[model samples]
Target: MSDPSAAGPTIDPMDTSAGNRFAPYSPENHSAPLWIVSILGLIYTIGVLSIRLFIKRRVFGWDDSLIVAGTLTGLVQAIVFFKALKSGLGQVPEHVPNLSTTASLAFTAQILLLIALYLAKCSGILLLRRLFVRDQQNTGRLCDVVLGFTVVCGIATVVMSSAGCPSTGSFTTHCSSTNTRWSVVTALDIATEVILLLLPAYLVWQLQMKTSYKLRVIAAFCFRILVIIFSIFHLIARIKYADTQPSPFNIVTTLVWHQTLLAWGLISATIPNLKAFLQSLSASWGGADWGYTVKAYGNGTFEMKSMGTQSRSHAMASTTGTENATDMDQKYETQIQTRQVGERSSLGSGGSQDMIIRKETVWTVVRS
Candidate 1:
């Protein structure tokens, strides 16, 4: 890597001297940055749609809120990075018209990226808590442990990022510390994602659902593995440029990988909540409702009717009662008894039994 400072004092853009010439911006230099911005925008749009579906179900929780917050921060970082590119961040130092402005934008963009990454990780942790922790009392313990660990990691990342480039006076002066900081942050990020992925695998395995259903659910949540893959790529890019002085290609590569990491992080966090939307779309296309309907009768009996194309019905007498004889049928008085039949199966050898009993009561009173 060439010493950036040894290249000489900053050159003014307006200087017409032959030695002070700067390369003109072209499509080659701008394409990567524009592509990164467009990708970020698309990911943000999808994340927003997923979150909207989640909210429409009236199941919005802390995890969803954290994801939204992280996304906003990521948007800010993207804008700042775009500005840095416009200000000559990915251009050769000699071609960079205003080095000071570019350095400032780059520093601000990194700080925002660190904060956004932390928030996204925390969002994933909160999501795991909501999915796996059923007991309210035990929720605090597991959530606190994960939250504290994430907070510590976040603080360490911010501190290191800030310490890496304490002053924006010169970009190359901080290369060594910046390299170490990014490597640490990347490792911690991969660790947190692994923890998030493992936390739910055990719970999913313990579910009483069919094996295929369990595998499907596990696969949906396992999308975080993509985020981990992106993080690895980002780490590799950082390492590749560890010894090189900041240049147009190096800066663009780092920015691209960084955006990719954040994009996948947001996507993974939002994917699970999209199941309801996907189911709705499938139902719309298939023109079938896949659920059971329960109807109660005046005789203290109820029937479970399958609503879809594969229709089946089950009727069980919940209670028996005799009405008191009266002058008029409408004037008769009766006391309806309610009883819950536990684990009743349909009247067939291979009928599937209801593993859980649903208790409901219906009463009619008449006076004349």
Candidate 2:
């Protein structure tokens, strides 16, 4: 899990490979900007969450619970980061009288950030699971696997941030996050983001919908890419600063990206519900469903139904018959007799015979 590039012994403080990021400048504080953005981001989340709860027949669910948890954790972590900022967190550690306090606060904030992300990411996964858990292809089983992997990786990040990895000492006391620990942690973070993204794409692409509709649904899920982008920035920041000595200057970018990742992660989890809520308004006003409507069924199953000009046709044939109440019978008889008087004149020994034939016909026509 250790990154060879960030090995402490090889790091050159005088060198600018981190590209002027650690340049000596006026000691600045990012507490206010971060606080403002963090508050606004959470408010956005809350606004969407309110709509979600108020929407018709919306029941409190596990995903919603995770959203709430992530939001709360993020709020608390923001406060911790602000406190760290107040104590020379953005200044050179040597210049600060209380380096230990700043380091501890920052470390705690890192753990909390990872925790909030874990919760938010799980919320999004569960929301997606509602759509795929019952797929005929059974990719929901893959969703399950991803969920387990996410949980494992998320916990691993928490462990790595709280206590150093490679079987080292505690985070604040002896173990330093700069020793390739954070590079590994951030790599895992990016991996989770990538995997979460792939699941939605895979599930949506396999759907029985028009290509346009599939794209629309997948586009709706694309909000997560913002999180991934921010995570990539976060990873780069971690790696760039990993070998840099702990100072407010070198840590500011990392701090900003950390906040960015947390806020966006929480917000992305709420986007699906919020997007549907907006689309519902559009639909009420006679607007398009943008190609699909997601229907959540009982037993936590759901599907995205394509919307368009659809027609259904049915045909039926009916026949009636009646039984005849009356019955008729007809009979024909024929008889033949030989006359001896005429035959005796021809031949008395041979006897002549006369034959008679009769024909009768009976007809009936009935229609019902």
Residues 164-231, candidate 1: write the lDDT tens digits: 46445445444556667778888888888887787667655654555665566567678989888988
Off by over 4 Å in 2: 1-32, 92-97, 135-137, 165-179, 280-368
TM-score of each: 0.67, 0.64
> Which parts of model 1 have CA positions greater than 4 angstroms off?
1-57, 136-140, 283-368
Clashes of each: 1, 1
Minimum summed lDDT over a 10-residue window in model 1 is located at: 309-318
lDDT for every model? 0.61, 0.60
Error of 2 at 12 (Å): 35
> Tens digits of per-residue lDDT for model 2 on 314-355?
100111223122311212122222221110111121331211
Q: What is the lDDT of residue 205 in candidate 2?
A: 73
- Candidate 1: lDDT over CA atoms? 0.61
Predicted candidate 1: what Cα RMSD to the true structure? 11.9
